[model samples]
Target chain A: DAGVTQSPTHLIKTRGQQVTLRCSPKSGHDTVSWYQQALGQGPQFIFQYYEEEERQRGNFPDRFSGHQFPNYSSELNVNALLLGDSALYLCASSPVGGADEKLFFGSGTQLSVL
Target chain B: AQSVTQPDIHITVSEGASLELRCNYSYGATPYLFWYVQSPGQGLQLLLKYFSGDTLVQGIKGFEAEFKRSQSSFNLRKPSVHWSDAAEYFCAVAPDISGGYNKLIFGAGTRLAVHP
Candidate 1:
């Protein structure tokens, strides 16, 4: 079975610009969550999408948003990017009620803000 | 608030040597703990997890973690370290919230380097 997949392994954006990263959850999974891993740091939770609606969110600002489609794919959008926004954006997925404690992650999209 | 702490920023060991990485977490109730490994340019891989029942959990690739409730710590250990075992290790905790889904709180991570 295919594992979690993310698009545009790497991306570049300038300050005040916008960017969107994509994620396709593992087969048989329905929930998608996003995380941000800064240099020399572990990933921090961004938000989670289930049933096409956001269920929980972390300490991110309004500029960061996400969407989950019927197919279980997800997209994370960052508006008005700042230099601090440069980091590895990771996508993780899990089944709604099955072993929710375990999450499968994608390689992640490296976002570089200039 | 739930949080994880991996005190070691980096550790180096010789091949064939034993290894141990320390992890601690803070949570009000019983916590769901996990250990994940990440290679350069790769995603996080679950090594093992502790929900309940047993304090010592065995995981893939010769990894094992022991969760101590009194200490509020979960430490990963391996009998023998391989060169390929070198990678960044993350300790995480999942707080049980209202929703069915649990969000993970990760530590700063401990980078392991193996010398042959």
Candidate 2:
């Protein structure tokens, strides 16, 4: 089965613009989580979606939001982006909602805010 | 607050040499821990994870990590390294399912360089 997959492998946007990244969870997985990884930094949790509702969110601001579809696909939307938003945004999927569940990650969308 | 810390910013070792990467975490309860590796321009891959049962957990890529609750550590180790192992390694932690969401707290990450 295919692992978690993300769309638009790379993206470029201007400061103050908006951008959207998409993700499809791994086969047989229902929970999707989004992460942002800055240069030389580890992935930071952005939020999580389960059952078509956002179950949890990180310390990020309202400008960052996400939605999970009934099919387990997800989308991350960032508004009024800043140059600091340039980074790799990753999507991870797990089979279960438990804390001990193993996560499978997608290659990620490299967003470059100019 | 749950948090993860990887003390090493970068490490360089000769191929075939033993390697170790340090990790530390702070959580209210017994935390779930994980080690992931990311190659250049690639996404993170799970190396291994620790829950309750074993103190030592073996992972893919010939990697392993030992969980030490007393020290709040889960350091990743490999007996011998290969040049292809050059990548960035991250340590992460999460609260028990009872806490909900399974959101992860990740460290800054350690970049490993294997020199032939």
DockQ category of candidate 2: medium
Candidate 1 lDDT tens digits, A2-60: 99999999999999999999999999899999999999999999999989999899999
Considering only chain B, report the TM-score of model 1: 0.95
Misplaced by over 4 Å in model 2 are: A96-100, B99-101
Leading candidate by TM-score: 1
Error at A101, model 1, angstroms: 3.7
Best by DockQ: 1
* Cα error of candidate 1 at position B51, Å: 0.2
lDDT (Cα, 0-100) at B53 in candidate 1: 90
Tens-place lDDT per residue, model 2, B5-95, is 8999999999999999999998867778889899886778889988789899999999999999899999999999999999999998876
Worst 10 residues of 2 chain B by lDDT: B94-103
Estimate the lDDT of model 1: 0.93
Reference interface contacts recovered per candidate: 0.80, 0.73
Point to the candidate with the largest lDDT: 1
Give the TM-score, chain B only, in order for the candidates. 0.95, 0.94
